[model samples]
Target: MGTMVISGTVVLVVLGFGNHTWWLVAVAVLFLYMQYGRSGRVGRGASTSSPGGSGGGASGMTPGSYRAYRDRRDKQARWERRYRREHPMEARRQARERKS
Candidate 1:
């Protein structure tokens, strides 16, 4: 993590001062920063879980579950839309899926 930040900063500094085409360096730095943030290695060490289970990097909540969860959410959204259209009164009466 430290390595990533240091490398990214070095690249940025070089790009700011050097005459070479530093786009690649900038890209590399961005990639490293993203990697670092994704791994939760910035202020703290890499975590076993990410902000969302959708991130394809190394984390918990298997890739299959991520897809399944997304699909379920989409399906739920569709159902909500249909329910609202079919039964506007019920939709206005109470919220579906209570807040947890």
Candidate 2:
């Protein structure tokens, strides 16, 4: 599925270049970048483990690391909640300052 889409896009870009349509070539390059460049799945020097592999999940996060990440995020959330509850005025002031 993905291959077919990419192949079709490449064909279009090639055809555009053959016809000397500079704008089409530019648009094709931009489209390809928008489709693939911003996606986090394609990172340089990053290794992705296969299904049922020795380590890591589908998103390349290992169990221990995922747990630690979640714990840190939860702790931060709890601290923020407690801070907002205990220092509403300070929180509000900080928010206002950030907005400006």
Count of backbone clashes, every candidate in sequence: 0, 0
Would you give me the overall lDDT of model 1?
A: 0.64
Tens digits of per-residue lDDT, candidate 1, 20-55, equal: 556666767667667666544453433455446555
Question: Could you tell me which 10 consecutive residues in candidate 1 have the lowest summed lDDT?
Answer: 57-66
Clash pairs detected, candidate 1: none
Highest lDDT: give the candidate number.
Answer: 2
Candidate 2 residue-wise lDDT at 12 = 69
Supply the TM-score for candidate 1.
Answer: 0.31
Candidate 1 residue 33 Cα shift, in angstroms, is: 42
Stretches > 4 Å off in candidate 1: 1-64, 95-100
lDDT of 2 by residue, 1-100 (tens): 5566566667767777668675476576666666666543443444444334566443565333555478679999999999999999999999999999
Q: Indicate which candidate wins on TM-score.
A: 2
